[model samples]
Target: MNFFYFAYGSNMLALRLQKRCPSAVFVESATAEGYAVNFSKLGRDASGKGALFEKQKSTALGVVFEIAKSDLKSLDKAEGVWFGYDRRTDFEVVTNSGETIETTTYLPPKMDIQLQPFGWYLALVVAGAIENGLPQDYINKLKSTPYQIDENQNRPSRLDALETLKSTGHSNWQDLFTSPRAS
Candidate 1:
């Protein structure tokens, strides 16, 4: 069996998602009405992570992917579903082609993310957003999103993971990972 998933954040990257679920495959760029992509999840690293929020006038743009149902468990663990998120399958993602897909997504139950995301984390998201050719405006919106430098200097850039996103034509990805935040 296979299932569709709406990947609005880092999972939007083909390389990253494929590593998590070897059977993952991109479906199309899609939109989630009434939601906005934001960094609000309290990550294990003690920094902010990506999640969704309700925004009446805005939609969270992302990609839809089909994955083997057998991979669901690993996906859950990788996304920290039980620790910081709850899995939900009731949402609909409308593809650019006007086709609606039935899929699952993970979101925290409460809006507790009060800090900025780490630059490295945000870079993965921005790169993935660009990889799938999400709307330019949306991509810029992601780039403009405020992110905090990873305070823990000892924490290394997720180089292995980042390689996946950088493969998507972002040779300058190195800068984006630690670019100066808007002052």
Candidate 2:
């Protein structure tokens, strides 16, 4: 069996998601109405990660992926289900073509408003949005989100994500480092 998963953060990048869930396959671009993307989830490295916040009259755009049921455990482990996020399946997202689909997604167990995402993390999100052909306005919004540079220059995860973005031929990948909103 396969399941639909909606990705609104770095996982929206196919390359990034594939590393965690090998069976993930892009389905379509979708929108979760009444939600907003925020970088307020506390990450293991003391940085902020992406999370969805419910906001009336707002919409959060993302990509829907079809992943094999067998890989659910792997996804759970990668998402740190025990502490980082709570997996939920009750969300309904509308695809670009007006089709509504019930999909699973992860939400932070708690939010810290003072946290901000690392530059590399947010870049992965912006790159994914561009790679998936999401709306320009939405992309711009993501790009404009404030981010902080990881002082640990040799962080393995950050290195790997930047390498993937470069290897994948994302033309503006370098710009992400220079153009983020003032931290």
Q: Rate the local accuracy (lDDT) of all candidates.
A: 0.81, 0.89
Task: TM-score for candidate 2, please give it.
Answer: 0.93
Q: Residue by residue across 129-152, what tens digits does model 1's lDDT show?
A: 878988777776788888876656
Best candidate (score: lDDT): 2
Would you give me the overall lDDT of model 1?
0.81
Error of 1 at 86 (Å): 0.7
Give the top-scoring candidate (TM-score): 2
Point out where model 1 deviates above 4 Å. 151-157, 166-174, 177-183
